[model samples]
Target: MARIKPQALLNQSKKKKGPSRISISTIVVCNLVVAVVVLSLVTTYRHWSQRSRNTLETQSQSHRFEDTNAASEQKSYDLPGYADINTSKGLITVELFKDASPEAVDRFLDLCQKDHFKGMPFHRVIKNYLVQAGHSQSSIPVEEWTSKGKLRGRLNTSPKHEAFMLGTPKTKGNNNKDFELLITTAPIPDLNDQLIVFGRVLKGEDVVQEIEEVDTDEHYQPKSQIGIISVILKREL
Candidate 1:
């Protein structure tokens, strides 16, 4: 120690310093790298979260639009329900009011659904008066109608049968069987409610007119064979 020079002491002092410049630089670089990695992680997380939020919002909007369309379509059609009576002439759709005549409507709908009126002729057609169909027999024998007290003379009432009325003549007796279906082109209320009025024409009045105008024999049977091909029951609009 007594022989040590000043330069040696200075060298010793440099060796004992807090840290080398290179070591401090290395620590600063490591810290910078760690900071950059943390910043990247934060930016990636933010971007993913934003994208997920946008996707969810788009799906929600699409669902709402679909629901709205479905509701609108349902509301536009089939108010109370009806039927399509297809004939050789054309389609005749009738909208039933069951509340007015429940039994008549029920029987008519059943017959139509079963195709009971298929190939039946509108045998009776009095121009601008009434058109009759939905029976296998051309006419309910005159005696049968008279015996049931439905001959349209017992009660001489006012008003010729109203236009476009779907009615069944109450010719069936105490057994309560449903009878012939007739649509009145003009008002003829003299039959004393002989026809159980039920439903009315909804569409195809022109077809009815065509059927009425066809040429007929002396017995009121159509010469051109205007018959019912089918009766399609349209329970909805």
Candidate 2:
């Protein structure tokens, strides 16, 4: 057997190992590109997930705030079995003494529910005395309210001097009058049994005071025309 030369032996080894298919530098570059792509995808996914979570949180907070405000409004302004009178000045809430003046209260509430008092001015306003309203026939001159019998025949009539004492039986008589209610600013003992005290102010007395302070004409009509805008009735809970 002939001895193989060194150069020939090296050539043979190179052939057996096959041709140089990939270089070290090429492998390193490919690995770096793959790593960069993976990093970019992870970063984009994280950013998108974070943005989605933030949007959901913001929407949830907004819904919660709206719900809280709605609940607050319901609790603040809605009391069952009370009358809320919307006037030009502001809201006035009154609690009717139904037990004492059942007929009178019922009549007044019925008129309110029917919107009969809307746009009716306080026909008679006496300073430091009482504020009287519910005159539906306010278009005519104040002097003609009674003489024309405008407010005389429309409401339930209770006998004059009907007793409205808490424990006493309701008085028997024709006392019901139409669209004429009084809110006394001061104590008027003489009016206790004489007039039907159907309801008293529970809130917004300041608005009533403002009404009383309005300038009035010689006939006790509000010069600026203070009127009832609307009336809402809530049942007592």
Candidate 3:
């Protein structure tokens, strides 16, 4: 056979087949699939991790509160009961935490059952912050003590004073004042150590908000009369 020229060989090599468009397309699709899988896995992991963290935080706050008077338990317990507070503005329902603070809950229930809180003014009204009642005196007069329920021994205080939580300010001594009630409209971490949290608002959040919006004077007393008309204790959820 006759020898081929170098230029001719080069031209033949140039004419050879390259990779097909279908193969390149296949490679691109595979890469996209792998990328999508990795992204999905990362997103799922992050979402689950966030949920776990939130649950742990909530448990820690609600269950792990250690107090000088009470011992905090990591385990769970059943809630006590519920109540309806009939205020001048509207009806407010609350969930009792007898297991958490028995003395406070019992005292509160006793007072409500006896209609002791009837016509007692919300003495301290801090707009958008808190609403306090059951003080020694107010524009509206409170009845005599029907039950002298005072806190004794291990007082299981709340870890946090979350919004809508019903609690009492600490007294001069180690125990909380019997009738110095407080209902927070916003998170009050500062009062966490100063109050004994025993219940939370179940319904009547609108009433709570309305109470928070009530006009107050220089001393935090409401301009218009806002008081607890009555309170009814029930065993409902």
Q: What TM-scores do the predictions have?
A: 0.55, 0.49, 0.55
Q: Using lDDT as the measure, what is the rank order of every candidate, best first?
A: 1, 3, 2
Per lDDT, the best of the predicted structures is: 1
Among residues 3 or more apart in sequence or in different chains, the pairs in candidate 3 whose N, CA or C atoms overlap within 3 Å are 69-154, 69-155
Q: What is the C-alpha lDDT profile of model 3 across 1-237, one tens digit per residue?
A: 999999999988877855535688888999999999999999999999999999999987766454422443322132238888899999998888878788777777667666778788887777656788864743222211111133312344344456898887665543323466678886655445567788899899999899888888777778898898877777665
Quote the positional error of residue 67 for candidate 3 in Å: 30
**lDDT, candidate 2, 159-204, per-residue tens:** 3322211111133453333446567665444343345566777788
Between prediction 1 and prediction 2, which has the larger TM-score? 1
Worst 10-residue lDDT window for candidate 1 reads: 142-151
- What lDDT does candidate 1 reach at residue 64? 88
lDDT of candidates 1 onward, in order:
0.72, 0.66, 0.72
